[model samples]
Target: MIDLAKVDYQVILLPPSGGKINITDLIDAWTHEEMEDQISAKVTLSLKNVKREDGWMHQHVFLDKRLVLEATDGNGWREIFRGSVKAWKTDSENHTVHVVAYDPNYNITISKEHYYFKGGKTAAASIKEIASEQGIPIGVIDGPNKPLTKKLYKNSIANTMMERLKESERKGSGKYIIRSTKGKLSCLKEGNNSVIYELDDWTTESSSDERSIEKLITKVKIYGNSKGDARPKVEAVKTGKTEFGTTQEILYKSDFDNMKAANEAAAEILKEDGKPEINRPLIHPDIPWIRKGDKVRVNSGTINTMCIVKSVSRDMHSKKMMLQLKE
Candidate 1:
């Protein structure tokens, strides 16, 4: 259990020269980080009311510096974010500084290139190759060994790689996700072990929203092209008629070669986009481990369901967690 009254936060600053400075006592920082599919994880650390000291200014803590934020409860300290500082701001009146950092992968910008992945490459292997080419440190990729057919990649290299991996997620064959946890990139498969967060009457605040949609998709037309077949189109339909009307969605692809692949693509798109969406925010707690892409089982009155974490915002000074849940 986290003692909200005495929660402790540790913030470290690593200068480009390489020594580390524990600035937890010197600065009040708020960190907000999010994990999203394909894109690099983002971290923003706002150091509020930091006392102005000699040899420390906005220009001195240039874009090359790194920031690490940690938190501790009854358990030992855990590092939440480790990122390179991208921008900083100074408030002269309050003698404070604000620093923003992002995962190292953010620096890996894709250049124009013709890239192709052979038919036997797994998504994890392909993602690893891309990260290694850009010199990004990676962690474990926990997913199936599902091999993909030959796929030609163009446009932003990173974006193309993400699209390929996301196909697996869309198909529901695997919940393979690429995420950065404290600067280490990994492609994680869905797991049964999830963090269960029980909401109480005294635990911060909670809100929920449920709305009906007028437009719902029940069918998907997937267009594809293969090596032998020039143009292949497959349609997947789910039997359902909404009160608003029947709607059809079209998905365009230039990659599938056969009817099986095209049909899989159509089914995945329909299954993914054909349902009503939900907006459920994360149940905020002082725990530091609740990050984006992690699943949490929440038990509140009339609402006891599992949700994937979308984003997390924390005030290191007050030790409060702002949760954003995704369905």
Candidate 2:
């Protein structure tokens, strides 16, 4: 389990073209609440100088629908994320977000949004797309390769049929049957009337007579026009299997549960009251100079080190600050 108190989210703003600026200078103004099973956080992000003609590009944050941060770019900035009200809130910390500025001629300016995280980092995809596609609550998985077993819809029946055939081969059945409303489908061994079976309605089956169908159904060919970046030949085997009376195989690819896990982990790490160790450079450098009312910290390199700085030489030659050392 991740500590939601440690993760941080923020938006970064970049100057218009030809403007000099530092990304690190922007401060994180938002704060997070205590860890709750359900909560929604909304942040309105508006930026200037984005190309109007270009379509919307989204950034995915690992959180619930209610916890999503909405951002708008280009003319008349629009809301990009909004749906369900049930979601988790974002944690507070200094975060950096990437902003791109584009001119009429397609010229681009890139900037960053700085933020903080606790246990680990969040997923790269935006939370909106994930929620819409996966049809699951946000922050479910927080690691890579996490398998999400989604129920099959009516449209997925064909794929499921193919998987059943593939599974039959793996189980040494070497035969299967698919019965659909249209007709009977089957694949059986030679001279094996004893193993014959009735086909079910609304299903597809494999048969020895139509063994060539397997090669055709499962084969994937890559095609391209020019050879420079043309497609390359690649082979993929079916993985998913189903067992009726006989067995069948299907070409099924696992879902991206890892990304969801990463998002959940990130959200967990962002919770409040979770103080995560972070690497930050000292605001002031250490130098020996005698000055009154100078603040300084001890030589402890830990996060809780005591440090201070006072008035310094304002002259051009000595562009340095005076500091006092304290134990």
Candidate 3:
């Protein structure tokens, strides 16, 4: 329950063999930025009055060297970021050493490869195979068991990995996140009811809500495996929402060739996404442990609901964070 607490942080250099070098005493300031939209999470630190070329950092740290950032409120150290150094700069006049590091995703985003998976690969398996081939280590990959077929992708490993993860969306498993954490790749299912964290009154500063109609779809036009110019063979039970005008989504599922199954699926998709999306942003005391894809429960004056964390923006110095939650 550390609210607006005095936060102390450290920057550590992790050697290849093992062990860690404490760079906290030498650091002047640091910042961290992590988001689902960004390809890689990043940490930037300033070392005070270190040698320009022959400093402790310059001598031991090289590209791909591990850098870890942690913070404490006297409750003990909590790791916030672990990444490989990409580049650095030495400020001679300012008497500072500026270093920039990013998660392993930085390496994946620069790599271009052609991938061809014959058929019958689950969403988790598909991304694991690609990450494995690219030499990235794998963590827990909890995804839906829907078997995909013939996933051919040609792009940077980061982009293709995201594309492969899109297949995890289905009825059984609602959504999945393809995240790289602590030098390991993971495809985790979103919104776990078992591990719901609370943004209670103590740590929550303020909150606001907004609405988005972008994903609202009224009617769904389902297409079968028929050839070109063929009309929709099946129609959903409920047509467009005439009250709010018409917003249509065409569902193309070759397996939905049967009329009954196609209509049911169309209605199901509409039921799931047909409503206006409510986006809530809460100003919470910065807690680095809260992560994207984690479910949180909130109960305020007329607001009582569970939500999935869509994004988090943290200020390392101020211990303030803006958490974006999805409905």
Maximum-lDDT candidate: 3
> Pairing residues by index, what is the TM-score of model 3?
0.81
* Candidate 2 local lDDT, 1-327, one digit each (tens): 222123223233222232222222232232211111112212232222222232221222222222222222222222222222222233224233332221111110011222221222222122223233434233322122112233232323223333333332332333222211111122222122322221212111211111112212212122213347765332232212111122222222221133333233222322211222222222222121222222333332332343222122211112222222221
How far out, in Å, is residue 290 in model 3?
0.6
What's the ranking of the predictions by lDDT, best on top?
A: 3, 1, 2
lDDT of 3 by residue, 84-132 (tens): 8888877778767788898876788888999886656676777777778
Report lDDT (CA) for all predictions: 0.64, 0.24, 0.71
Clashes of each: 2, 65, 0
Error of 2 at 156 (Å): 12
Question: Where is model 2 more than 4 Å wrong at Cα?
Answer: 1-69, 85-327
Tens digits of per-residue lDDT, candidate 1, 87-205, equal 88888887777877776666654354567888777777888887787777889777546667687777676676676677655544556556677678877664333555555546746
- Candidates in descending TM-score order: 1, 3, 2
Worst 10 residues of 3 by lDDT: 164-173
Candidate 2 least-lDDT 10 residues = 102-111
Candidate 3 structure lDDT: 0.71
For each candidate, give its TM-score against the true structure: 0.83, 0.14, 0.81
Q: Weakest 10 consecutive residues, lDDT, candidate 1?
A: 233-242
